[model samples]
Target: MAKKTKPIRPPADPLPPVIAPRVSAPPDPMSIDPEIQKMADDLSAKVHSPARDLELVDEFLDLYRRVFQQGNPIGLNEDITAVLTGRNARNGILFPPASPLIVKGQLVDRWGTPYWFHPNSSYQMEIRSAGPDKNLFTQDDVVKNPGPDNMGIGVGISQP
Candidate 1:
């Protein structure tokens, strides 16, 4: 008797490949054009200086205390001490020239970049960004367009 022949098996199908989600790169402050980067670096250097840092902290604290006493909206540059300590204090404070508070008001940065300010505590007093220009006109200068670069400060006083 003749031996029976065996049948050949079929090949299996290949599995589908997995795909990953695409992620966009974050904007780099250092890569914002050579000129802008240089300006930013300079401003950063100034801010990091030990003497400047101390002075800024002192000024911020003073502003905080002033706002706490006045119980009114204060601008970024207004002499907070005078407002809080003097009876001539206005009910509402104006934004100082190129003040961070101005950016907070306009909802944009020195380069027209937008940002948000969410104070973690009521006692918190100020918000600011020393952009490339290091000027306060962004908050106070009446110019419709205060160039593309300027520094700013924001002062706030919350209810007790």
Candidate 2:
């Protein structure tokens, strides 16, 4: 006896191609004043120097202390502030500016998970991550120290 074959089903109505949203590129970091750019370059170059690193870190900490003392307020974004202050420092020939400097920090909790923070805002202002080497919310992993053998902390300071 021959077996009957099942009839083929017709294709569903063709769906329109799904298009992804376009992402705008981030603003250029070089658009800042040439003087400020020079200062940033100078600082970046000295970030590895032993004495200079200590001085920069101390300057960063001092600025944060003052900002905290003034009470936490909104509109304290660091990127723009850094550029403004960096310009002043460059013109004044100051290694670091007198304004509050924002620097990135990373600490591993007891569970071995890293917690990111910006030292300029507030000590309690932590940038949380998902868990276990997973930087779910952050744009990238916490920057590691670039010193020889990673002896010092990998820190970045904002100009403001």
TM-scores across all candidates?
A: 0.24, 0.24
Report lDDT (Cα) of residue 3, candidate 2.
100
For model 1, the stretches where C-alpha displacement exceeds 4 angstroms are: 1-65, 70-89, 92-94, 97-104, 125-160
lDDT of 2 by residue, 42-83 (tens): 445544443343334334334444534532222333432343
lDDT of each: 0.35, 0.37
Across residues 33-106, which tens digit of lDDT does each residue of candidate 1 receive?
A: 44323433443344454233323433434453565563322443334323322323333222222333233334
**What CA root-mean-square deviation does each model show from the true structure?**
18.4, 17.8
- Residue 135 error for model 1, in Å? 22
The candidate maximizing lDDT is 2
